[model samples]
Target: MRVLSCIVGQHNLWLVLLAAVVCVAGSWVALRLLLRATDRHGVQRSGWLFLAAVAAGSSVWCTHFIAMLAYDATAPVTFEPILTMQSLLIAIAGMGAGFWLALYNRLPPEIGGAIAGLSVAAMHYTGMAAYHVDGVIAWNMNYVVASVVLSVVIISAAVGATIRGTSRNSLLIGLGAFVGGIVSLHFTGMTAVSVTPFVTGAPIADATVFATMAVAVAGVALMVVGTGVASHLIDSEVTHENIAALRHLAMTDSLTDLPNRTGFNEYLHFELQRAEQGGRSLALIGIDLDKFKEINDLRGHEAGDEALKTIGRRLLNLSRGGEFVARIGGDEFAALKRFRNDDDLREFIQRLEEALFKPLTIEDLEITCGASLGIAIYPQDGRDAERLIGNADLAMYRAKADLTRTVCYYEPQMDEKSRERRGLAMDLRSAIEHKELELKYQVQKSVESGEVRGYEVLLRWKHPERGYIPPSEFIPIAEESGSILAIGEWVMREAAREALAWPLPHKIAVNVSPVQLMHVDLARSIHEILLETGLPPRRLEIEITESTIIADKVRSLDALRRIRALGVTVAIDDFGTGYSSLDTLRSFPFDKIKLDSSFMKEIETSQQARAIIRAVLALGKSLDIKVLAEGVETGMQLEILRSEGCHEVQGFLLGAPETFVADVVAVEERRIA
Candidate 1:
């Protein structure tokens, strides 16, 4: 202990401490650089590894010689050039190995730590061997072994802390490990040595050694900082690219690679304002693909996606100068087109139709999909974006509803109708909740027996102020507004319950909308309703339009089969009015087919209608399915249907729809008499 105190007193303590500080600062900086190098993505990171080796190696070498100057030996102390140079090379090689283990191989920190501790021990012992003294020196194996062991344990712990700890904490750990290990090893090694006086020998000057090491340390520090700066630039570039990609994804549709609804709305608003100031009119053409749901049903969704992409490409091609095209919804698109004259606008519409009418080929199938376009002019239709878009949507629906019209202009009457329909839909929700809807029964008579077979349940709604609203008006409105799900369920539950109180053994036929047929759990709902009403499945018939199955054939057929499995019969209503294929009847197991009312109106005068009815009846006969003719209002029409061998008939001629069942047995007896 006295020898250690005398040695510390002999040298300049401040310079010794400053050297230790430099050791810690250099080590911390080197560790940070190595960490940054490993974090970087590519080949450019390798430069930091070399920088770490140089900084860490130079620090240990400088710290050792600086402390050696404080040795205070009797003879002058100097370093052997070859041995000292070899120690520096050994230190660099050891640091390189430690870095490779921790960064490249991704070994646990303890393993890299052990390697790092051993590296420092090797450099320290090798530098000690380079000591030139004019005395015979003896080493105590106990102290020498203790110094090496202490270095290994303390340096390893420091390396481990630096590796495991966060960035800010790592610096403190690195400083402790590097400077602490160097000082501790040197003093412990000094304790092991006993020097005996002998002949004097010349030594290297302290001033020259100190100046050279200070310059070396400064060079290593610069290298580490430069590498760190280069790595920061690379990371910044990568961050910029990622941000740009995110922005593009936010505004663009991934499926079609076109502007999405948000992007479309932004562009539309800007264009609308530009047109208003310039005194030029702009057109918002809202486009809806007709029978798109059918395509999705007939083909899978994958094919449907391909069809949408194809449509987007075609629309892009048709977009003229100063026009913007975007896909706003599923099966819906919008275009903002500017025009100088009415004739140019008409020409653009004609060109758009020509482009869309062309067939799209997808995976061996050629699909001919048509589009319905609704044009809303700026300033005339609306002043704001929301109003313009809403008016355009209403016009699109109007064009879609009429088979002959492919395009329709926004009319003020359409908005009034839309508002009325929306108001009716809102009221329908309340009506269903309050049980304001009524189910009227229309008798279906057997043509041959003149007996009432069953009654078709018809929905009726009467507004408080409007008196009575027709089903044709409110039913469609309810459907479009998605209020039909609740209303339809109520109708089924009510009709099934009402049948239990009727005096007649007549089956109740409840109409199912296309939307209602889309429910996968329709069978479960019906089962619950049957359990609630205590009505047998045999007495409940679900009548679906041909359009219902045409919308989503697989799903609707699955729903029908499930319902039929519950012992209830399924019938196709308004059959001929829809695109009913004879194949659909063969494929789907329908128990009955109700001929459309339009066919019956012409049956009295037109032989073509009569012959068509005969063919349908013949088909039904061959298939062993009952064919009921609807809308038999005139006696002559009933007679014509009878001659054609219609199985059942329902119209005002037989009986009108009555709110109450009204002693149904008496009515049947009266009809028979």
Candidate 2:
């Protein structure tokens, strides 16, 4: 076996192409195996299978080139030694270059295989031609012709595999096979050249020469067609997987991993269809976790998530045949059972309540959570999924309102409250945009100075039909509906602009909800408003509750730091109402602290409340943070706060949150003067 000396003792490069043909066969089989082995879970293992296919393919390529040169040994009688020496050296270098290029071409699988195959055929032809062609460097025209034909075959195969199939495995196999066939075709041609050197003087009729060339061309065409068919099958599999994922997303809550509102709707529809077909009634039970915020404040969101996951699992396990349970919204879940009467469903809900109340162990500590459930029997309490779900949800809220796990049926009165919340959410959006929500300054004066220095921008929503609605009723509603972000931003911008407009020029404080603070661009919005209003950062104050800051401390701190960096003042509102640790206030740069009103209200009757206030004042003074007392309604409370060295005071005693009516501060100043 001798065609050229490249590796050692006249290596045959055709042998390398021969091994590639064998690898093509092996890759074909692996493609089929990979397609069948890949169940839904098996899709994750696709990367390893692909590697194995590529390795087998390159090996075949390596071996074929090595064998080709080895077979070209028959030369002229006298110059056999010199010819053999030259060919063997070229063959060895060609093999090394082929392997190196294979690595470069293996990137990103699909197109890599097609390009690598054609490149190898081109490289082998060039490497072989370097032996004895011209003084000015001649090229192999036949190799160029072969490469063009082979490239066309490989490209056609890839297009076919991509379009024809649903499965990914088929396309990969089709790609590997198509490109591989083109490269191996060169080896078949080499085999033909040696076997029929000079049988028919016409140079085309020789069996060995003509047969190998014909077979090589035909092999390219056949493999291209074969691979093209397999590619489209892979596409089908991909489409099927996508549809399943979309359906799951439509039903499931991404955060809680429970079925959401839409999911509950679809599930109820399906259950009703089954129930109607079977002539049975369906029991729709809605459950809402009670006091979820307490857990969030006491244990943190990590514990809250664990509680939800634990509750979800417990509810899923409790559901029986023809029963479906889904988490419909925040702190809300629904379950439907194909049972007649509300009594049995009520009993099941009772058991669910007890199951939910039982202690759960997460991270080695025992924790407790409870649920309030409401039940409505299908066909008895309205007929459709929407009506049943709405009735159940209304009952659950009423159950929660009383702080009881007792199952209640939906009453006509509950719809009024639901409609009220919907109307408020809609009005809140309009109120914010149309400037219907106004800032009423409740003057915060320095008790010692007796001078009006700052004002808390209290939001007053004046409705045409409902009169003035207090923020206490609508704020929580806005926060729940996610309209708080827009409202909060509007409040901050308006407060800043109005404070800058005030002739007295006192600092203004605006409140931010946990939802607003958690928004990543909270600071950007604040900075833009300051820039737009021409208000100096020093004159504006952003008030956040302790609970809001610690909601997601890391992210919250990031927002706080950005706001603080703008030189704007930050004060914790309702500080003592929550579990505000002294260390948290010390860690953050706080310009002021507004003592919770409940603590101030209790100061008159209770000595312990006064002592707590004293300790807080001392802590504030030690940290150099100015202390302000909120809800100072009585003169006695104002005097106590004055003696305590409280920096500022705000409440009904000073002035209630009244509409400024062009210039209320000026009118109030004249009355005080």
lDDT of 1 by residue, 1-673 (tens): 7436645754556556656766766676677766766666566567767777777777776676666665556666667989888888887788777766666454676566567667777887888889877778888888888878887777777767776777786768766775677677777877777767576556534655655565565456445545545655676688689888987898788888778898899999899889989988899999999867666766778989988898888877878787888889898888888899899889888877886778978788787788999999998999899999999999999999989999999999998887787788788889866667888889898998877789999999877778778998888888888888888899899888777876656899999888777853889999999998899999999999877887777888889999999999999988877544685897787899999899977887898998899999999999999999899898888888788789999999988898765545466556556
Instruction: Report backbone clashes per prediction.
Output: 0, 56
lDDT (CA) for every model shown?
0.80, 0.66
Cα lDDT, model 1, residue 115: 73
Model 2 lDDT per residue over 631-662, tens place: 98899998888887788888899887757735
TM-score of candidate 1 relative to the true fold: 0.63
Which candidate leads in TM-score? 1
Residue 567 of candidate 2: its Cα lDDT?
90
* Sliding window of 10 residues with minimal summed lDDT for model 1: 220-229
